[model samples]
Target: MSRTPPGTRADYAAFTPITTRWADNDAYGHINNVQYYSFFDTAVNAWLVRQGLLDITASAEIGLVVETGCRYHRPIAYPDPIEVGMRLASLGNSSIRYELAVFAPGNDTAAAEGHFVHVYVDRATGRPSRLPDALRAAAESLRAPGSGSA
Candidate 1:
């Protein structure tokens, strides 16, 4: 497979600034590998919440992450402010693929990048559900221009 080059903030549809906590650093002093996934989830969910598309506690439909992966290009440590850039790669009947990148403060290139796929499902029944209209529209708005088949 071809390697994906690190992305810049401009490549994304939206950006969220994240403050790294002291607890995020590992024994080696860099952020733990798993924390990148936390950043991914935070960025996407924050956008969805801001758009009035997600009601974590009461929404009839909720997104359940089905797949996730990340590529690390450099180390990010506590005390370093980070930015998470996010964009939609595609949207399906009940799923959406979100692409994300983590940028060190003031850096143009991503320190890490990744993607996660979430399938919308009934909160109670755990079965696939059609993407809610508002959510779908909001997701569409996050599609990067000329980037993917969203």
Candidate 2:
């Protein structure tokens, strides 16, 4: 497997604090690999909600995640109060790519980093829809410098 270098807080535009629970640990004593994806989702949605781009119950348009990936640089165990950093890697008419980093308390470098892709769709039809102006603008605000043109 190829190794992925950890990213720093400076690489992201926003952050969400997350606390690891006892259940986050596994038999081996570190966080379960599956939980990392949840952190990514939480961080992304938190930003969207903060920007007023997502209304879970009433929005006609919603983002449906179509792809995701992660690379762990170190183990994160229970009781670690971490922060998940988020930034946009790419934006499109109907899609967006998000880059995320999980940082241990007081650490500048990420313990894990990942990417997630979401395709905007009409909630009723489940068909691809052009991103709303507000959503697009909000995403642009979080675009990483030199990452891509929004």
Candidate 3:
């Protein structure tokens, strides 16, 4: 999804600190590729929950992941923490695109970078729904002004 290289340390907004477990590593001795997406999911949804936009268990408006992509630059191993940085790339009427970068603790470069698009839908009918006002504003706050020009 990116034309440039892996994200550097400068591009993100809020960071969520995450602990890595021994099981997070694969036989190759690094964090498995699939686990990176889990980090991305946690970082984004945690923000949604904290913003009071998502109930997860009862919210009628649910955001379902429709698309996802990632780019890896380095390997991460257990015994180190992760700083998962996140930002909103776009806030649409019914969806939002979230960009994420996972950096090893105390490191300035990213181990993996990715984006996920979630389309808000009705829990009962599973139909697409417009984003709530509060959620849109929260998403807009994380969007860089000039980042979505294209």
What Cα-based lDDT does every candidate model obtain?
Answer: 0.90, 0.90, 0.87
RMSD to the hidden true structure, all candidates:
1.4, 1.6, 2.3
Can you write out model 1's per-residue Cα lDDT over 1-150, one digit (the tens) per residue?
A: 988789877888888889999999999999999999999999989988889888889999999999999999999999998989999888899999999999998799999999989999999999999989888788877777667656
lDDT of 3 by residue, 39-146 (tens): 999999888888888898999899999999999898999988998888888878898899899999778888899999999999999999998888887876676444
TM-score of each: 0.94, 0.94, 0.91
lDDT of 1 at 122: 95
Q: Which model, 1 or 3, shows the larger lDDT?
A: 1
TM-score of 1: 0.94
Query: In what order do the candidates fall by TM-score, top score first?
Result: 1, 2, 3
**Candidate 2 pairs with clashing backbones:** none
**Tens-digit lDDT track of model 2 for 1-150:** 966578888888889998889999999999999999999999898888888888999999999999999999999899998899988888888999998999999899999999999999999999999989998778877876556664
- In candidate 3, position 136 carries an lDDT of 82
Ranking by lDDT: 1, 2, 3
Highest TM-score: give the candidate number: 1
> Which candidate ranks first by lDDT, i.e. highest?
1
**Which runs in model 2 stand beyond 4 Å of their true positions?**
1-4, 145-150
